[model samples]
Target: MSATAAERQFDELASLYEDVAPWPFRRDIEVPSVLHSLGDLTRSDVLDFGCGAGLSSRLLAGRGARRVVGHDASEGMLSAARQREAKEQRGIEYVSRLTPELEQRFDLVLAVCVLPYASTRSELRQMCASMARVLRPGGRLLALPLHPDHAPDPDYYAPYGLRLVSDTPHAEGGALRVELRAAGVEADVTAWYWSRNSIEEALRDAGFGPVFWADPWPPGLARVEDAPPALHAYLRRPHAAMLDCRRARVSG
Candidate 1:
């Protein structure tokens, strides 16, 4: 399978990504919210878009999803995911992408940290539309796109395994590049900034709404005590945002 630029970047970073995500974004926020919101997945079909090494897919499958499909653009990441599925025997189906031929639709779709990889406005629009297409009407989408309000500052996120390596202005808007580092592991990733207006516009055009921005301290936080103390302050300020949206139902 051909790799997207973002996919190749992730492929090189996949091993380290399993160990060190950008901290608060993954551990303190997105993951907790996703698992909490999916309270009763007993018979739900779940899609983990950009499933990476399949961490979210396995989590959803074990939590009683009737079917869990992990779709990613990187073959390396999918290979690792399939290896784990082989060992664990979880009924997860990993694919490079959701094709037109696949008639199945999901009840819930989780796209944590997937949007910022889009380098262009049209790419982002296509992604949002593609996600909408795979969801059954009334299906829910949880998207964690990077916050346009918070472009990286030097030393701002150093405590959380991320360092602002560079920033440059683009015709599209602001862009920030950062390096994820921890204990002898390092990987460079770029996150494109999209205004809230553009993001909401894309979702609305894709037939999803009324989109709701999730609260930083979701009710799920009360159950997780392992989050580091430093996260509390950052939570109050928006570094990234969770967009909770539902596909609109068509009228008969």
Candidate 2:
């Protein structure tokens, strides 16, 4: 399959991207938040839309999802994911394309850091449509996209081992340079900025119902007041936001 610009970039950064799994913010905040929002995966079939190294895909399988299919355009990332599946035998399937038989076959689509790869409004709508096509009616989509209200300061997320810089931070379809750093490993990727209104419109036009912006909270923490200083600060201005929406059920 031909690679998109984002896919090619990730193909080169595959190893470093896998290294990001253990980073504090991702391990402590992002993963748990997304998983919690996805409660009770038992017997569910899930699509991990941007399943780099199959991190979330493995998690879904461990959580008792009957089947997990990871789809990505980066062969480099898929190679790493397949190696893990070979060893662990988690029964997770990784592919570069979604076939006809897979259409409307999943109960959920877990799209971590996938939507912002769309550099245009049309691309964003197409991405949403792809997720919608693979989901059964009333199935859910859980995504993490760049927060429209994210702090523009390049250093704002430095404490979390992430940096986002944009010469045109407020402009729709503007490029955002994202840098991830941890344990002496660093990688950079490009994502586009889309306003919250634009995102909601795309989802709705793709046959999804109302969108819900869910707040991220650490798994073990009962309240935000209980979080430590650094965690609290990151939570207050997270660079990405969790979006939950469902496909509209067909009216008979």
Candidate 3:
């Protein structure tokens, strides 16, 4: 997708995004659990990349982050976040710019459902690098993405989305209306399913020491009927199945 188109796509989604996404929004999980597992963030500066409507950021604030900043590429989303912030009387700093005006060095960075919208690997890398650049040595990152191991392929490009064999609303024959990316969006725009080695390699390449991995199938969203056995067993086997990793201390 062209830069302009990419911007417009999110702008449109921001218009009625909240209404269509209420249930999952209410069920959001990875954010808090990941934070808690990392221990106290009360005195740490935090950054929420792809902050979306700032729902997760608000959660961080309630958890008592020293200072929180959210950055996204969509102005409409930022506006929505601003509205929410004003309504709740919270003090999150939301910016539409991809890179926030931050040099204070964050102790933690939280990203959920980011990377999917990235049109290319480079964009994803840039975002990762941006986080590494801003984080203090030893800081941790908790990232969540929609393209769970069994993601419903977006745009039918990558062929990784959940394939239903039963039935559901948006889906009639196969598994269910769980997923089927429209032609409008490119497969590349969706977060490519990064395998364990790839993520480790990418993180190390970006200067982040590998900590661990988490929820291959986060219950944050509805379950896909045809999710592989490995996916189901992992999510249900133990809530702590996901990875919890950290970077080494700064050497400089």
Per-model TM-score, in order, reads 0.88, 0.96, 0.67
RMSD of each: 3.0, 1.3, 8.3
**Candidate 3 local lDDT, 1-252, one digit each (tens):** 123344445654553435433322123333434655656778988889877778778878988999889977777788889988889887899876544446437888887666444444565566677767768788777776432343233223223222222222122111222232332332222123444455555567777876566654443346644545433432443222244445557677
Worst 10 residues of 3 by lDDT: 168-177
Better of 2 and 3 by TM-score: 2
Candidate no. 3 TM-score: 0.67
Best by TM-score: 2
Cα displacement (angstroms), candidate 1, residue 81, comes to 0.7
What's the lDDT for residue 22 in model 1? Answer: 42
**Clashing residue pairs for model 2:** none
Give the C-alpha lDDT of model 1: 0.76
lDDT of 2 by residue, 173-225 (tens): 89989988768888789999999999999999999999999667767897766
lDDT of each prediction vs. the true structure?
Answer: 0.76, 0.89, 0.56
Candidate 1's C-alpha runs over 4 A off are 21-25, 165-173, 218-228
**Shift in Å, residue 88, candidate 3:** 2.7
Query: Which structure is stronger by TM-score: 1 or 3?
Result: 1
For residues 157-251, write the lDDT of model 1, one tens digit per residue: 66666765444522244556767776677777877778778888999999997888864455535533445677754565546677889999987
